[model samples]
Target: MHHRATTSRRTLLTVTAAAAAAAATGATASAHAGASGDRRLHGLISRMSLEEKVGQLFVMRVYGHSATAPDQADADANLKEIGVRTAAELIARYHVGGIIYFSWAHNTREPHQIADLSNGIQRAGLDRPTPVPLLISIDQEHGIVARIGEPATLMPGAMALGAAGSRSDARRAARIAGSELAAMGIRQNYAPVADVNVNPANPVIGVRSFGADPQAVAGLVAAQVRGYQAAGVAATAKHFPGHGDTETDSHYGLPRIGHTRAQWEALDAPPFRAAVAAGIDSIMTAHIVVPALDAAEDPATLSRPILTGILRERLGYDGVVVTDSLGMEGVRTKYGDDRVPVLALKAGCDQLLNPPDLALAWNAVLRAVRSGEISEARLDESILRILRLKAKLGLFRDPYVSHEGVDRAVGTRSHLAAADRIAERTTTLLLNDGGLLPLDRRERPNLLVVGADPASPSGTTGPPTATLATALTELGFTVAALSTGTAPSAARIDEAVAASAGKDAIVVGTYNVSATSTQRTLVSRLAATGVPVVTVAIRNPYDVARLGGQRATLATYSWTDVELRAAARVIAGRARPEGRLPVPVQRADDPTRVLYPVGYGLTY
Candidate 1:
């Protein structure tokens, strides 16, 4: 977990590109020169025109598999809209200060390929007459919202780490995760979700958060920040003022957090305060509306009081105030794509992340600056914060990564082993009504593994992926497997139930059961078979509530291959279930009637 960071890809690119930059009279990555780096910052800002300065606030996305970002229409469509073809064009055209990569962008299996792509982006930024290396980043929040998967250590999620109940382990998990990004040349990580999942009915921030308790979430978030920052990656504590107590998904529509100022301070702001206290250099604003802080019905991402008054003045946090993706429906739809970026800047955000239309947003911000709607001083303040972060990251010294060391450094065996241990530790067995787990293979020798594959409706290609079925097989069981499609028909459930006929014991895996009634129904049907079953919620911990009359129930809170195998270990008795529930579990129809409250798990 304490592995040294590999050589930077930005450093490698610098040696080759510095000569050209020198010839053009532009500084290399090392633009900040002087004892205090003050003179250099002033010189750079002084030279920047209004357009260039405004451009520094936007952070554009470049997905891995696609030429256009995830939010964009298509490659040609993006070109027609923005007059830019690829990330390279977007960077040049807008002078984007940062680039965030999604799974589609950094989805390569090869570590070197990821490193090269990141290094290329940094090189592009450094080539201009006034050069500042890009803040290459990804939302690698492990578990649920992870971007870098497979080749990298798919570290157990924030809740899993909280379930493991060790701050040191939390730090270790984040460090392992950040090491991968650092090795791959991505210096900024938008992670350490600061939302405290107090509302059991909350849709989005469930397992992504640390826990239901404010104090515990604070400790966990602070620890993760330390771990990530120590590994030379800047960590951003996100969804500020809490995105936890909401029923709506910001990706789709507006979510209103209707807590009083006192309630908000008690439940949501504690974690954010702790994050800032721990020196979190960046905090991403949430899109949900915190009415107590701002009564205008504006989301936190565009609220002056929330971003500037609360986070900046009240909390006394001066680190970067980054807005959540501007493209999210929560804010983007409220103020058309072009207007959101400028509004975000005026609202006191330092970095505008993932604006839907890069050119339009850039032009809007530029216009705002030129028209004096956004002051020049305010522009400098935001860009200066960005430049200060780059300087702190030593991006000015050497911003690129070396491809040669990526294989050695990113997702090494040690990191993966640690991740596996963390996963195993967090695999919570909520129920074992009949000691049905640790299947006495000798007794339950004919093992039948079954579940609904998330991407198995016939046409999609999802990993042929590591399912609990494969995992049980690897544990030396005669695992006959049956996978129903995502939306299992009644017939399909009958078929699955039929498959469990001769099996001594059945292990059913549930994926995202909170939202999928089909998977929940399949579990109920399997229960009707009365095969002494054990249900594992592969994605949602709340799946137990969805399935009634289960012989036993377990929760892994993730579907990563490592977590699947970890669940296997727990089921096979190779490892004990050490995790406690991080969220409260209640009766299916009742939130007040708690069945298994926060910090509840069973082990033999």
Candidate 2:
């Protein structure tokens, strides 16, 4: 994420001083290591033909048969062969500099699936003796976006970290996330999205961003970057410039940045700037278009003026520049005229990720170099950065990971325990009327839980009902779980209403954020009946805002196993809701603004 600075003079001075010190230290290391590691890296770059150097900058996917395609049965055999043969041959034949793993094929694989996958791909990269190791990257952003297989430590998304409002909390989350990926032999993470969540309606970046406040988001981004890099995983701050304001998802088509270039400079660029200053190792280009920045191009991914002119020149970002997945419609739909890899590289991207067509990408880059379209110098420029990144990652020394460290890294008991701490800290109480919470399990032993269904599925899990029932049961509350899908199914609502009618206190877990009509109506009905509706926002906090008159809401941010237990602790009066809303919660009529600003939360 190359962010143009909008900073105080004092901060600028501090940054300049830090940069100077880092340069001196880095020069010393490079001078000492140049003979061995640095010399080999330089030698390989010198010996590489233009084709090979260009290949080093291009990272493509191993495509499988389309899941939506019709001839599935026949395609299955071809897909497996495609996975092994395409992967194996890429190393032997193309010697592609890097490879990206798509999570589709290995959905059912075991916990160490990534370990095996990374090993295979790295073996392919090392088939030939390159002085430096090849780069491998994955999209292992936590929450709904995790790409690693089973026993994945699915923590709450960035929004949850925002909810915690603690730098230490975010740092710990990143450390665990980094450890998990590194344990799997994966070294790069396309994560810690620095985009400030300014637009609630943004489909692609809704919960992915930290929050709306630039300062808070910046702090969290910095913390996460340090944690991830400290753990030896290269953390990437993504969607450069910003992707937080658009309503459309760039995955489907080009999303234009309506903000003027200056407006973007002021609002969306702060966190990214903080990230770069924090030494985030890589920046992923967004698929969105900014006409102010690139009037001639629809998407920035294909625009050199934006990528090279602005991101490189104006911002002075020297890190590896990776493009968002090239398989997205944003690039494929518009730039179908030319091969994507060539356009991306010409646009100053150091890596072409998940290239839709590998042979096409390879030949296009090769063809560009042969035809003098892209200079050998430009190719070298990118490879230099790539090699530098590999060296910085310690990959140049030895890309191989120890086979002995498997038991302690991923999905271990300790990692799960850490996940629980993150989950516990992320719970927030958005609303509490007259201290109507902390359902004393000893006092209100016969507790009833209403509104636990797919309609209320937790954002942490991205499924139907939250685990409130299990959490309550664990707390020894005589609990009952019921779903109120769009409208409360008559039977379900009646049962909940009857059960809670005279209970000492009722804890209603309403999936208030974007709830289905039935779920919304059920919540309304329950609220009208005068039961203590401890409405749990298992998803977005805006869900509580949507329940305009329903002021008795609690936001757990997500329904991860960790969050569920934490929410129960809050209900049982064991833990306090020390969190605040990371984003503003607006009233229905005032969609443009928020009724309760970020950082508004109640105490027990």
Model 1's lDDT to the true fold?
Answer: 0.78
What lDDT is reached at residue 406 by model 1? 79
lDDT of 1 by residue, 475-510 (tens): 777888877755788998888888888888888777
- List the candidate 2 regions with Cα displacement exceeding 4 Å: 1-39, 49-51, 63-86, 129-132, 149-152, 450-466, 484-516, 548-551
Best by lDDT: 1
Candidate 1: residue 573 lDDT (0-100): 87
Worst 10 residues of 1 by lDDT: 456-465
Alpha-carbon TM-score of each model against the true structure? 0.90, 0.86
User: How well does candidate 2 score on lDDT at residue 389?
Assistant: 73
Q: lDDT of model 1 at residue 414?
A: 95
